[model samples]
Target: MKISLQINASPYQHQAADSAWHFIQAAILSGHDICRVFFYHDGVFNALRDSRPPGDERDVVKRWSELHAKHGVDLVVCVSSAQRRGLLEQTVAKKLGGYQSALADGFRIAGLGLLMEALIDADRHITFGD
Candidate 1:
């Protein structure tokens, strides 16, 4: 099945991000296709490249990057939401004189159009948080 996911909560602060990650892993193992993961609201924190957790703790951002690297899953951060939270894409950040590397690897910043496309294209659209 082709599945699309939306996450609205922040990593660590809430369980939604972690649950979405695990769900994606399980779905992939079951031979399912992940169409895209749309990060909205605080969920955009999952795409921060500079996120550094303790060595013992799992790095959620890195896990997301690796998911895109290994499985070719699309990790998309909502442009408006990210901007509200101070996360900007490379080009936009440069133009706005903001942090250039705000976004992590394998994740892209886009408008809601991509999210709508994923929802319309996927067989199932699962949302993990409010």
Candidate 2:
């Protein structure tokens, strides 16, 4: 099955991101394909490159990056949402004279059209959080 995920909550503050990650891992292990992961609202925080969780805790951002690296999953953060939350992409940050290294590896900033396309193309479109 080709599955796509939409996350709307921030990591640590809610269980949605953690649940989504575990689901993605299980699905991939079961021979399923993760087409994309669309991060919206506070979910965009998951892609922050400088996120530094404590050594005792799981690094959600790093886990997402590793997942993308290993499985070739498309991790996309909503552009408008990201901007609203101060999570700028490299080009946008550079143009705006903001921090140019905002997003983590394997994650890209895109519009809602990408989410819509993923929904249309995937066998299942699962949403976490609000």
Off by over 4 Å in 1: none
User: Over the stretch 3-94, how does candidate 2's per-residue lDDT look in tens digits?
Assistant: 99999999989999999999998998999999999999999999999999899989999999999998899999999999998888888888
Note each model's CA RMSD in angstroms. 0.9, 0.8
Between which residue pairs do clashes occur in model 1?
none
Question: TM-score: which candidate is best?
Answer: 2
lDDT score at residue 87, model 1, on the 0-100 scale: 92
Task: Looking at model 1, report the run of 10 residues with the lowest lDDT sum.
Answer: 92-101
Q: Among these predicted structures, which one has the highest lDDT?
A: 2
Instruction: State how far residue 124 of model 1 sits from its true place (Å).
Output: 0.2
Local accuracy of candidate 1 as per-residue lDDT tens digits, 1-130: 9999999999999999989988998999999999999999999999998899999999999999999999999999999999998897888888889557699999999999999999899999999877
